[model samples]
Target: MTEDAATIPIRPAELAAFLAARMCHDFISPASAIVSGLDLLEDPTAQDMREDAMGLIAASARKLADLLAFSRVAFGASASAETFDARELEKLARGVFGHMRAELDWQVEPAGVNKPAARTLLNLAQMAGAALPTGGSARVRAVEEAASIAIAVEATGPRARLRPEVLAGLRGEGPGEGLHGHWVQARYVNLFVGDAGGRVFADVAEERVTLAATIPA
Candidate 1:
């Protein structure tokens, strides 16, 4: 076994803090853009560039909305035993993916429910979103099992980075290299799945990375 094969449960509080910080960082960019757009809207000559300014404002507002909704499902406190519509979750995943410049190809079942399953899907969506740098397709699907559910994220993109340590962390392994935001996210994903008694698998190659998780029924 190599260093990347060790398994460890990450500190939940720390992982939550990291995610909060990341969300804040991303929100700040669009928030600033919104402020700038507003300032421009108030200008006497703004009417000449009304279309452009309005576009900027709309884009920023959408980004903020996506971030808030996604973060709520990912890090916020919610009932773990409630039933949530799979279609609704799929829509949420699409919203999160919309913020990216990637070409996404997703297929989700009509309707389903399972809080753990929903959370797992959300994590998978976010992780796959990060893997695609040059904008590739991400496909997701879910199936009900005897006493659980299986969720998968198959992504293809240029410059995909699924390092061994990061993969290890996603598999409930020890702390991987924290050099990148993706790796940090992987650690949290690993912990979340592990805590729910689920497992994550990854197959990373030259131009593709596939991640999947199985959660209890």
Candidate 2:
């Protein structure tokens, strides 16, 4: 069946570029902070603030490392591993959540998941964390349901909300007036899930947002 013109998939080149840009946006902040911290440490007149500089450097370094590791599995081709351990995925999710205001609750029932499901879990978990700008909790759950894997993330907080572009992306639509960084991740999840004979869903309510996907096992 032909896709509707308005909901056509993005071109390969465009999608790749958008994804790259989005990852860069995520990394640049902590990378720049590390640099700034180093600059402060080198300033002889600011020796009194040396401890502060070191603290900043250490925290930013950890955050940078965490984001990089999470991105590798969520967005990049994480080697040739066909299946990923659920425990490791939870660690990755926790690493990213440590720096965010939101908390993570990983409750995956499966011991392992295929490539597509792993990516979906990681991306949705991160997206759920993002939904809560203020403090909140993002619960990530995945289980084997017959011949498929069901993944759901519920984000609840003081002001939990899903971005407009994110909804559009999950529906396999373009960003329109939304931010590219947010839209690209959702679109990527949608593409991989659809390719694996699955679908993605998102629902927004007062102080809550839910994201879900199912991938054929």
Task: Estimate the TM-score of every prediction.
Answer: 0.84, 0.96
lDDT of 1 by residue, 29-104 (tens): 8899898888888999777887788899999999889878877776552545377777677777788888886655
Q: Which one wins on TM-score?
A: 2
Per-residue lDDT for 7 in model 1? 50
Task: Give lDDT per model, in order.
Answer: 0.74, 0.93
Say what the RMSD of model 2 is: 2.3
Q: Candidate 1: count the clashes.
A: 4
Residue 71 error, candidate 2, Å: 0.5
- Model 1 — TM-score against the truth? 0.84
Error of 1 at 166 (Å): 4.0
